[model samples]
Target chain A: MKGAARTIGRDLGRIFQALAGLLFVSILVPLIWGEYYAIPALVVAGLVPFAVGYILTSRFRDAARPGKLHGMIIAALGWFCVAIFGSLPFLLIAWTVELAPPILGEPSQTSTLAAFTNPINAVFESMSGFTGTGLTMTDNEEVLPRTLQWWRSFIEWIGGVGVIVLTTAILARPGSGSLTLYESEARSERIHPSIVSTVQTIWWIFILFTFVSILLLWVVGMPLWGAINHGMTGLATGGFSITDNSIATYDSVAIDFALLPIMLLGSIAFPVHYLILQGDLRNLYSDLQTRWVFIYMGIGTVLLTVLVYVSDTYDSLFTAFRYGSFQFVSAATCAGFQTATDATNVALGRWSAQAQLTVVFGMVVGGAAGSTVGGIKLIRALTLLKGIRFRIADVFYPETAVRRLKINGRRLNEQEIRQEFEEAAIIAALWFLFLGLGTFALLIMLPQGEYTLENVIFEVASAQGNVGLSAGITGPESLPTLGKVMFLFNMWIGRLEIIPVLVTLRAVFDRGGLYR
Target chain B: MTVSDIPIVGDLLESGAEDRVFDSLLLAGPVLILVIAFLGRSTVTVGLAAAYVLFFVAYVLYLGVRR
Candidate 1:
């Protein structure tokens, strides 16, 4: 147990160090913007965690090597730790902006940075940013200083790739349990033989895409600053936006449509992208998840367009299809980018229940497993669908029948089949469980007349699915403390896909040996 | 040997016709909706979309036979 503590502490410390290093890099944002007040805030946030990390690592240097369970604990706890410490910037910035009022003579009175002074709200915003669930506490993001906006986008960009991957790729030494840590972050595919190499390749691929995404957006008439932030968040599938109304502020269908490819690019598994990038263009069509990405997004777009058009939500089929296609892909990819902002410029709150429900299905299904998007993921959804057919067909088979299950070109024996099926079923069941609990929580806690059951379900699914398509429920001070906390926990568990969170909880309760 | 016996090439060409069809479907989906949205979902727009679909189908069939 002492040995376990030492190893766990060491891993967590490394994660903290990685986080601090990212924050230290972030100090340059405030520097560039001439926001002198933000510098110390970022520094304090960076140094505290860095100091804590250094102490723990140095104290636990000779601990036994961490195992799989340690990886899960580290991932779950480390994410929470980062989110907690990550809130410091939001908190300190809020206070500094309030007290000091932006020494750079930047926009002061209108800034919504004050909302983060509340610890719960601060943590909620931080959690939302780090989880890549872009549900925000601030009502007006346009008034937020450039430094803060950069922080939000930067964290989402990193969070999309995951801090653990960052830690493994840059911080942790090779053969230092990188594989388990990487796997624990719910990343299964290894693009390279070494886990470190795989993470590095993923980062390289991400960086290349980010630059291209930025350039494309800029060429399409978005200003360079907005383009840079949108490019990062869009490719991350992390929908944090600098503007108050999100991408809706532009109200240009061309820009709305422009982000679709980048968002879809983010929704795809990195390994698939790697294959296509490495000249295996055939994988674009043949890869199971990639094919499904197109199919699901297409079907969803068609269905949503019809529903919105028939419902007369947008007053015309053109407008309906515009919002429908973009919003559907945005939701399905779990990018949570906004195109559903109608002429009134409100979000999906005005849409019919059927339309919102359609988006909810997208939120729950999310994108591919290895992608940054959240929710139950397509692999599990496909597994459950196939499992149903396999079970039904089993009834007609003879007692001595020898059957092998196949999925995505892989043959599975009996145990493998059962394991995959069970895992899929458990995740699906748990996803519904979390969503149900979240909706129930909001139902009792949230004020009435503002939102309906569909809206509540949509909001909860967005939070639990790590999709940030809100229906006017989430806010900094507007929501109850308990509700904010609920969303914070929902986003946390959702980003980790429920298992790591539950594993951490169970392990905490067990008090037994981590290893069997 | 025939292409199927050489695994790698077969995998690479794994129904290139089908992939083309898939690509067309993907491309046509947005175009179909956009045409309706922009030009209205009138008979002309519907005809255009249907024409694209039919063309892709015919092309797939032609390619299938040729290969």
Candidate 2:
């Protein structure tokens, strides 16, 4: 028991050290922007974890072997701590702005920082950023300082790939614990044999894509700062925007076009990216997940366009297709950017019920597995669909006949097929169960007759799927404390893919639940 | 080769047109409510809701008969 505790501590120490490094890097944003007051806040935040982690690592260095159970616990706890630490910059910046408004050199925006002073709101924003959920507590994001804006986008960029993966790439030496930690982040398939090399390769691809995206956005007429911030969050499939109106504020088709490919690239699995990088175009074309994504996008776009046109939401078929296709791709990829109209504000909120439902469907389906985006995942959905077909076919086949289920050209034996079906069913059931529970909770908490049950379900699904599309329900100021907390829990669960959180909770209450 | 020989396409074709129609309706019924609600057609909403409920009842009966 003592040894186990020590092992947990050492693993936690690695997480803390990673947090400290993130904080240290975060200081550069404020320092460069000449927001000196925010620097001390970041430094203080970094120092606390750095000190504790240093002590823990020195003392418990021997306790280094952490199995799957430890991995889940560490991931859950690590993310929780990172969210708290990430909130420091927001909290400190808010305090500094309130106490000394002139230090930031923007008097008009000083009042905006007061929103972050509330611990719940600050943590909610931080959690949203880190989980790549892209929901914001700030009512008018345009008023936020450049430093905080950069911090928001930066954390999402880090959290998009994953915090544990980042630590493994830069901090962890190759070991059993390192591999377990990497797997705990919901990334099982490695592009390379060595976990370290896989991490490095993923980072390299991520960095290369980010640079290309930024350059493309800048060339398409976005300012350099806007391009950089949007580029990071865009490729991360994180929907956080520096503007009050998200990507709608740009109002440029060129910018929209530039962002679409970046979102798609981010939504694809890293292994696919590596294969494509190795010049395997055939693999890219043949991959089941990729094919499913294209099918979903094609069908969804056509359906959405027709619905929006029939509803008379847009002026013409051309406009309908343009907006419908963009929003569909965005929602499907789980990237939250929306094309805007001058009169309607966010065109998404103004969409008809059928169009909104289409978007919600896309959000629920999400992107490929082993990607930054969140939802049920195409792989799981495919498995569920195929499993049903297989079962039905089995009923028709002769008892003596051999049956094999295939996924992505790989045949699954009896045990593998059963396991796949079980996993898909279990996760899908849990997803809907939680979605229903969250919608019910919101319905009870929200006032009657103001928001429809459909809208409530849509909002809940958006939160749980990490899609960040709102139906006029999820503003920081307007949402009650319970509602905010519920969404926060949903985003955390969604980002971790629901199982690890369940495993962590089970391990906590049942004691030996993980081992059993 | 027949459509039934294709992979995912084959499965869908084998499921029969009746199953396909029912499956699509099952998926789209709730969404139809949202559409009606958004349009603010109260009379249409009532009709749609009644139809949706009836569709479910029929589906249950069909499943029972098939079993």
Task: Assess every candidate by TM-score.
Answer: 0.87, 0.85
> A487, model 2: CA deviation in Å?
0.9
Which residue segments of model 1 deviate by more than 4 Å? A101-111, A342-346, A511-516, B1-67
What tier of docking accuracy does candidate 2 attain?
incorrect
> Candidate 1 on A374-482: residue-level lDDT in tens?
9899989999999899989999999789888988889988789999999999989999998999999899997877679999999999988888998888887567899
Q: Which ten residues in a row have the lowest lDDT in candidate 1 chain A?
A: A102-111
Considering summed lDDT, which 10 consecutive residues are worst modelled in model 2 chain A?
A: A340-349
Which segments of model 2 are wrong by more than 4 Å? A101-111, A340-346, A511-516, B1-67
Model 2, A301-320: lDDT tens digits are: 89998998898887788878
Error of 2 at A193 (Å): 0.8
lDDT of model 1 at position B47: 62
Find the candidate with the highest DockQ and give its number.
1
